[model samples]
Target: MSAYVSVLPQKIPRQIAGSKSLASMLPTMLSTGVITLVATAVMRLLWLGFSNDFFGAWMEAWLTTWPIAFPVAYMLRPMLNHVSRSMSQPVVPIALPVRQGLMVSDIPHAAAEATRIAGLQVKSLSASRY
Candidate 1:
């Protein structure tokens, strides 16, 4: 039992190696790559102005900037997840008085109210309008 227990810790590295941390970092790498690629290229071009060696300068800047961006972006992932979750949650509909009557901005409620005021059933709203 003790032998088996001792082997478990030793096996953890093998598992980690198998998963390839690089694979996990792929999304972060790709997203940050695109952002850094464009940013570095544009900034270098703008600062130095156009040159026959633009491609060389862009590649150099991109390589240097990405090392910094990758770690920063990876570290920010948790905060990003939190923000995205909060933003993505179904917004609680606030009940507010319609100050200007129903603008097209109002949704089903506006349609229902119009249908009701017109002496037509809600179902009639879905019916063909001739």
Candidate 2:
């Protein structure tokens, strides 16, 4: 019996060198790549409807936009993450007095009164349950 030879290479060269920094950037790189790919294709389609040149135009646009998008997205990722975290948390509503017929001097008193009224309302609500 003749021995079978595999066509595939035994060792594949690493495309990207793995490191701590690269690991940190991997998520941003992947997300930016996917977002830019879809956005560029969609925008190109919208601007110039399906044609024989559509694929070429879309590829060109994606190539141009991705370089710019990746750096901007990487830089803004921290701030955006912070904003997203802040937005996702539960928000506590503060009672504020309506501005109608209220003077600057009465602002403090009005706020205090609003808080007092709010506390009373809460107490009443809890009391009603019993």
Candidate 3:
């Protein structure tokens, strides 16, 4: 059992060598690729409406750019997830004590309250200590 456990980590990489992480990305990658292509096509159509020669020249450039952009957008999923999750959770607001609708911004008030509570607690504990 000990020998088998020792060799487990070495076997994991070999198992992953033939597998496809890229396959999991295909649906998402293709969707974004299509959207980019459509937006490019729309711009080309608008340009063609004004000037056909310029649109034809730019079409080849847009097509070539997509191959690079598609892979990059696919790879960016993990980073996007991290950024979104980090931003989504809200910061806990600090509790501020209010006195007669006024914020009690004095440190002494907190210290006094804590001392009073601790004194009462200590008295109760001492009464019960056995």
Candidate 4:
């Protein structure tokens, strides 16, 4: 009906507003929470071994850190965005002169040493290799 069509657009604006608000706020809330939880747990565990009262300590640490982390995250949003943008750049392959000096082994640090010996610059994360 004509009446329904006119009313629909008006209602749509309210839906759009709600969706935009949630879209912007949800990521920040989730990242802040996840970061807070992990940071608190790791720091607390290191500071006060896995004592029986870990739950209490974690809650206390989270309460203390939340106030600080929330503001810092908001303040650092621009800087973080820039850093994230830079990190997401496509990886470029660099051809390094292969040195046959170091032996390649299944052990973890051996490969790192081999790369170092070869003077190769590798990405922290290899895309297709992983």
Top-scoring candidate (TM-score): 1
TM-score per candidate: 0.55, 0.54, 0.47, 0.46
List the candidates ranked by TM-score, beginning with the highest.
Answer: 1, 2, 3, 4
Please give the lDDT score at residue 122 for candidate 4: 81
Tell me which residue pairs clash in candidate 2.
none
Per-residue lDDT for 1-130 in model 2, tens only? 7598778867766557876678678888899889989998999899999999999999999899888998898899899999999999986566964456868998888877998987854333566678
State in Å the error of residue 103, model 2: 42
Q: Global lDDT for candidate 4?
A: 0.80
Candidates ranked by lDDT, best first?
2, 1, 4, 3
For model 3, give the RMSD to the true fold. Answer: 13.3
In the range 1-130, model 1's lDDT, one tens digit per residue, is 4555444545334433445777778889999999999998889889989898888999999999999999999999999999999999986558954375546767877777888899986433545665
Of candidate 4, the 10-residue stretch with the lowest lDDT total is: 7-16
Which stretch of 10 consecutive residues in model 2 shows the poorest summed lDDT?
Answer: 120-129
lDDT of 3 at 108: 67
List runs of model 2 lying over 4 Å from the truth.
1-17, 92-130
Q: Model 4 reaches what TM-score against the true structure? A: 0.46
Per-residue lDDT value at 79 in model 2: 97
Candidate lDDT values, in order: 0.83, 0.85, 0.70, 0.80
